[model samples]
Structures are given as structure tokens and as C-alpha cells.
Target: MYHVVLGVDEDEQRAESAAREIANLPGGSDEKRVTLIHVFQDNPSGASATQVASVRDAEEVLKAAGVDVSISEASGDPADAILELAEEDDADLVVVGGRKRSPAGKALFGSVTQTVILNAGRPVMVTGVPTEA
Candidate 1:
């Protein structure tokens, strides 16, 4: 029963896809143990993830895929929050949706997944999208 982190960013489609993919992991569905985590870069001003979908959506997706689900929502620096939760939960794997940013985007804001990959102690699985979001 390895803990899986689905890095949700208000973008529902991306979040959903990432969760399903992780749920499809080799032993994920068989053991029925996985979790969804959404990190919001809200702070320094008081901002939180605007709810467009319920936690049930996350649960249902994995449940339908034959995996048990634990869900969480957080606000703060995206990278720090994910790594902290993974360590605290003793997660075996940290799964995140990787965004394809243009050079401009990269120049403006760095990659959270990259930072997490560099710092997280656990094995990390990053799902990279071909198209820009």
C-alpha cells in the first residue's frame, strides 16, 4: 500500500488524468491503496483552490479503477507541501502531473515537479503532458 500523490492545480482535467494514470500503476489497483493530494500556491495573500470538483471525484476515479482512495487539499508552496506530506505519510511514490511550459513560462515561473524530484526522498513518477495547458 504505497501512498500516491495526485498534484491537483485547479485544472480539473489535468488533475483527473494524473490520478487515473497513477491508479493504473502496476500494483496500484490490485492493492487498492492510493491517495490524491492537491497543492495550492495560496498564501502570502490568502488564496485557496476554488472547488470545481469534490473530493469524491478523486475517490470515485480511483475507486472505479479498483483502488482505495485517501484525499487531501493544501495551501502553500506547492513543492514544499507535497514533499512534506510524502515524508509524513511515508509515501513510497510521489506521482505528479508535469506541465509543459513554454520557454516564456519556464522563464517566468520555475517547475514545481522539478524541484520536488530534486528534493523528495521517495521515488517520484511525473506524468508529462505533450501539449501546453
Candidate 2:
């Protein structure tokens, strides 16, 4: 079975886009297992990954598409947590959502997506928010 680590942030659109991409993979749902993960940088309230709206939405999309899904939560640096989870799961692929950022902006704020792409030992797929016509 193909295993994918899907790292979802707070953005619903980006999460859904990534879920849709996984759902449409050529091998079909039965051959794939998706681990939906959300890393909270700060959570004084102690929230679970499934409580995150984007995570829930992505789970719904994946389930509707007949994909097997599991939710995971971690508290720490997002990129670090995601990469750790991928390694632990022995994921076939790591998928993340990225926002459009200018070079200067990305340089100033750093990018988890960029870090994952550069550091991941496994293949990484970056999905972006769709643009409206």
C-alpha cells in the first residue's frame, strides 16, 4: 500500500487541494493510506488535530473520495514534526500546502514548504490555493 503524509495547516483551501490531489492518484483509494497531520506551534488550549477545521475538511474530502484516512497531532515546529512523522510512517510521499510568497517575503519569513522540499528524504508535493478566473 502507498502511504502519504499530508501536512495540513489552517488554510482550508490549501488542505482541500492537497486532499483532492491525493484522492485522484492513479492507484485508487484502496491502495493508498493518508495520514492527515497538523502541527500546532502554540496551543495553550490543547487542541487536537481533528479539531482543526482545515483538518476536518480535508478528512471529509478524502473520505468522500473513498480514501483511507487517519488524523495525527503534534506540537512543535511544523516542518520538524511533519518530517518526523513522514520518516516514522515511512511515507511514500509527503504533501504540503504552500502560499504564494515573493522572494523577499519568503526570505524574511522563512517557508515550511521550502524547508520540507529541501530536507525531506522522500518525495514532497506542494499544493497551492486555486486562483479564481
Candidate 3:
């Protein structure tokens, strides 16, 4: 089984791309379990529509492919939450969405993707949106 990190900032394309990549990954079976996770910084009010929509899109795609899928939400640091869940679940891999950010941008803003990639013990697959120059 694998865990896909769904950030609050993610869009439909990001969600769909992650699902497509998972679906195409070799060795998938009906026995495989895929969890779509969205981490909110606070989320006192509950999940945002965007987050719900993204999860639903990925869930539908995976379900239609006959893969066992589930959705989860957490509140905390995005990178930490993702890694903790992955470790807790003993996931085979970690998949996440990324954006094209310059080095300075990443340094200034701090990237969840980079943090997860650097800290995660298991494999991490980063699917990114194409950026225009």
C-alpha cells in the first residue's frame, strides 16, 4: 500500500495526476490499498470544498480502477503529518504533488515536497505541474 499526500493548496490537476501515476504504477492489485491524505494547518471548521473535491476525484479514479482506496484528513505541519502517517501505516511508497519553484522561492517559502523527500525513509514520488517559462 502507498500514501499520497494531498496538501490544502493542491488543485484538481495535481490530484488527478497523482491518481493516474498510481494507477499506472507496476504491481498494482485488488489487494493493494491506497490512501489519499489531506493535511490542514488548522481546519477547525472542517475540510474545504477544494480539498474534498480533490480527494473525491482521486478516490473515484482509483476506485474505478478497482483499487482499494480511502481518504483521510489531519491537522498539523503538512510535511510532518504526511511522513508520520506514512511511517504509521508502513506504506510502501509516498506520492505527492509539486510545483515549479525556484531555489530562492523554495528557501523563502519552504516546500512541503522537499521536506518530505528529504525526511521520508521510504520511496517518494513527486508528481509536478508543468511550469511555463
Candidate 4:
């Protein structure tokens, strides 16, 4: 089973890339369970259309690959919410999607991906967004 953390604001293509990586994992034909989690920075009245669309897109991608999937929504610090949920769910792996940033940009902005990688107690898989030329 895997706990996949997705940024609600991320581009759909980037999010699907993460799903594709998980779907391509060895032994994935056994109907592995995937929990797709999205942490909303702002607590909206409810899920917005864009959030729903993003979740549905990722769910479709994983399902097409034969994964049993569930979607979750939370509001808080992105990295912290993901870590907490992964630990609570006893996830075997953590998967996250992110865009590559320059070293200086990462240092200055303090990336959530970096924090999750540093703090997650389980194995983490990172899928990078394609860089625009």
C-alpha cells in the first residue's frame, strides 16, 4: 500500500506523473491500495471544482493501472499533514510529486518536498515534473 501526497495546486500533468510512477512499480498487478491525499492550504467551504478535478484525474490514472484507490482531503501544513496521515495509515511507502527547483530557490523557499523526504519514517518516492525549456 502507498500513501500518495499531492499538492492541490500542482498541474494535472505533474500529478499524473506521480501516479504513473506508482502504477509502474513492480508487483503492482496485485491490486495494491493507494491512498491519495491532498492538503489544502486554505480551509475552503468544501472541495473546489479544480481540487475535485485533480483528484479525479489522479484516481483515474491509478485505477486504469489496476490500483485500488481512495482519496482524502485535509487542511494544514502540507508536509506535516502528509507525514501525519502516512504514519496514521501505516503506509508502506510515501509518494510525492514536485517540480525541480534551483538550489537557491529551495533554500530560500524551504520546500515541502524536502521536509517530507527528511522526516518521513518510511520509504519515499519522488516524481519530478518535466521542466519547461
Model 3 agreement with the true structure over 1-133: per-residue lDDT tens digits: 4444443345777788788778878766565678788877767677653357777888887888888887767777879888888888888888888765687786532478889889999888888765559
List the lowest-lDDT window of 10 residues for candidate 4: 1-10
Summed over model 1, clashes come to 0
> Candidate 4: lDDT over CA atoms?
0.74
lDDT, residue 106, candidate 2: 68
Best by TM-score: 2
What value of lDDT does candidate 3 attain over all alpha carbons? 0.74
6-85 per-residue lDDT for model 2 (tens digits) = 99999999899999999998897899999999999999998898899999999999999999999999988999999999
Q: lDDT of all the models against the reference?
A: 0.70, 0.91, 0.74, 0.74
List model 1 lDDT by residue over 51-101, tens digit each: 437344656677888887766768778888888888888888887777667
Candidate 4's displacement at residue 84, Å, is 0.7
* TM-scores, each model vs. reference: 0.77, 0.94, 0.81, 0.82
